[model samples]
Target: MIVGIIGGGQLAQMLAMAGQPLGIRCLFLDPAPDACARTAGELLCGDYGDARLLDELARRATVVTYEFENVPEASLRRLASRVRVHPHPGALALARDRWHEKRLFADLGLSTPPFVAVDTRADLDRALAVTGWPAVLKTRTMGYDGKGQRVLRTPGDVDAAFAALSGTPLILEGFVAFDREVSLVAVRSADGDARFYPLTENVHRNGVLVQSRARPGDPMASRAEGYVGRLLAHLDYVGVLAVEFFQKGDMLLANEMAPRVHNSGHWTLEGAETSQFENHMRAVLGLPLGATHGLAPSGMVNFVGYLPEASAVLAVPGTHLHVYGKAARPGRKLGHATVRAPREGDVLDALARLRMLADAGGAG
Candidate 1:
């Protein structure tokens, strides 16, 4: 079967790589002519809203899926009339808006940080009064990797935050003094079978994911798995969905949900018995979900800003590198490296070594 993936970025590139060996052909559509996935599959370069191009894509592929949630809803609706789109557009709608997402989570009996809509200055002030100060103001749509978000520590910061957003509909979320941040990458088949990978402890640098390590001993691990199962059933969701959480004391507060494969699950490519991309493909294709087994205690470190020194990092034992093959730019995620060891502690040590090498300007 041929699958046309929207948004030719690293996620689509990796999905193409995974589908190739499984006898599935992958095609990509993106505005950028030089997108990384363009090198791996048939590339259709054009605006997402170009109906002519979308129709051509639908005719050529057996099914359609997206690598990112920012895909135009109208485009998806138009394509759905022709070809199958997995995880469904309804799921995308919920994932695309923070307010709707919080409501969905709350409806599922899941706990989320207090949040209120900010459509006007009055709404912002009201949200602040209700949720309190030290809140986060985020755009209602197309916000990711720490962009389109600002922290309001005091009342003085509110105007600047709103000014930065420039009147876009927003969500003011109360800040939870969290103990740690973690995410669960789960997949559900079309028939409703669900599976979850090990929870990952994530650390962010300037809003972008910098490192993720498997947290096998987390007390909330079971709760996270249960939450994912409930969410998948609630959305009737099929394909990989990642749920991020803020751990405060004994509570795990829902932070956000991604309808597609996530960066936090990058370790699964080498650390798990089944990679998330493969599982996502299987789920969408009505194939049985693969095992979510951890091969070894693993750590995934993102290579952002510039391409990391791959040759130097490869010289280190048990290090596996995957480069996205994108052009260099400040704060751009160019690639990632996964280090594995017999024990989880050893994986952490390897991450420390990798960080030192990075500090010394050593190449992969």
Candidate 2:
């Protein structure tokens, strides 16, 4: 079967690479001339709203999916009329707006941070009055990797926070003094059979994810599963979705959701019995979902900024490096590396060793 993937980034590239072995042809759509997926598939360079490109893609692919949540709703709606789009556009719409996301979670009785909508200055003021200071002001739409968000540490910071977003739809969220942030990567089949990977403990630097350790042993894993179950049932969602959470005391607070494969789950490529990309494809294709078993205690570290020296990283025992062949730029996610070891060995220790190798300019 042919699978057409929207957004030609490393995720699409990895999806294409994984699909190839399964006798599935992959195609990618993106405007970036040098997008990483271009090297792995037949890339149609065009805007997501370009009807001409969508028409061509529909004619070629048996099914369509997206690599990122930021895909234009119009594009998905247009394509859905011609071909199948997995996980449904409703999920996409929900994921795009933070206020809607929080509401959905609440409606389903899922735990989420205290949040209020902010569309106007008055809304911000009201939200602050209720949620209080030291909150996070985030754009309701088009936010990722810490972009389009500002922290309101004091009352004085509120105006500047609002000014920074320039009156875009917003969500005023109370800060969770959480112990750690975690993500649940789960897949729901067309038949509604859901399988979940071990939860990942994430560490972010400046809002961008830096590393993820698998099976962090948070009691929240079961709670995360419950949240995913309700979310999938609500959307009748088919294919993979990742939900992020903040652990505050014994409670797990919903942070956000990703409708596509997530960066935090990259360790599954080498660490799990079923890689997320493959499971996502299977779920979307109406095939049985694969096991989410972890092969080992693993940690995935993102390679950001300049490309790291690959040789040094490869030299580390149990290290697996994946580099998205992209031009080097400061703060850009060039690729990632996963280090696997026995469950008895310290996962954090492996992560620290990988970090040392990465800091020394080891190849990624």
Candidate 3:
């Protein structure tokens, strides 16, 4: 089987890695000459919206999947008419814009922080009037890892935010003072079979995911599953879907949803009975969904901005490192390490040991 992937980033690289044992050949469409995923698969170097390139990818792969939501909707729509695209272009379109995403949650009877669309100064003020102070102003499209967003703490910050983020479609969302952030990563096959991973508690630094701990049999697991169920049935979604939530006093408020495999679920590479990347491939191929059971208590710490020494990361007990083979820069995600153990305490200890290795800057 051949799979065509849009956006040749680390996620695509992982997908290609996961597909190899299944006799799945992966190919990628990316404009960047240096896209890291090229090492994993054949690359069709061209603009994302280039029709000639899209036609070539459609002709070559049995199915198409995208690594990120930012792929041009028109391009995908054009390609989908030629070859099958998993998760559907509609789902991709919904995930691309925050306003539509929040509205989908509302339509599905899921809870989300109050939000209002903003397109002008007057719209910003009106949205603020509805959401009040300490609200977040976010671009509706193309924002990730804390980029394209600003928090307005008071009335004083409103004009500046509007000035900075105006001239683009935006969303003003009420801040959720929640207990913690968690995510449920699930895969739904075309046959309607679905499996969900354990809920993961996530910690972020400057809006980038830094750490994630998978807690099996968590109390909030059922609630999170319910929300994801609605999403899967509604989208008739194929492949992995990750929904992030803000937990507050037993309530799970939907924060955002990723249509593809997610960063928080990276621990599943070593911790779960089947890795999410493999399950996603299975789902997209209309194969039976794999078990989502966690094999051990697991934690993943991302290596951002820079990488630690391979020997140091390997020295930590039960720690596995995955380097994306990308150049490091401030706020860039270069790699990650996953630690697993029989007990949660042991996992935490392993995580601590790995963190020390990462912090010490052990030989890069």
Clashes of each: 6, 4, 0
**Candidate 1 — what's its lDDT?**
0.89
Question: All candidates' lDDT scores?
Answer: 0.89, 0.88, 0.91
Q: List model 3 lDDT by residue over 222-318, tens digit each.
A: 9899999999999999999999999988788999999999999999999999999999998888778789999989999998887988998888878
- Top candidate on lDDT is 3
lDDT of 2 by residue, 112-173 (tens): 88899988888888998878767999999999889999999988898888989965788999
Candidate 3: 10-residue stretch with minimal lDDT: 355-364
Q: Give the range of the ten consecutive residues with the poorest summed lDDT in model 1.
A: 355-364
Q: Give TM-scores for every candidate, taking all chains together and pairing residue i with residue i.
A: 0.97, 0.97, 0.97
Query: For each candidate, C-alpha RMSD in Å?
Result: 1.7, 1.8, 1.6
lDDT of 1 by residue, 259-361 (tens): 9999999999998989999999888888889999788898888887766577878876788999898987778888888988897677887787766665453
TM-score of 2: 0.97
Which scores higher on TM-score, 1 or 3? 3
Which scores better on TM-score, 2 or 3? 3
Clashes of 2: 4
Regions of model 3 farther than 4 Å from truth? 361-364
Give the deviation of candidate 2 from the true structure as CA RMSD: 1.8
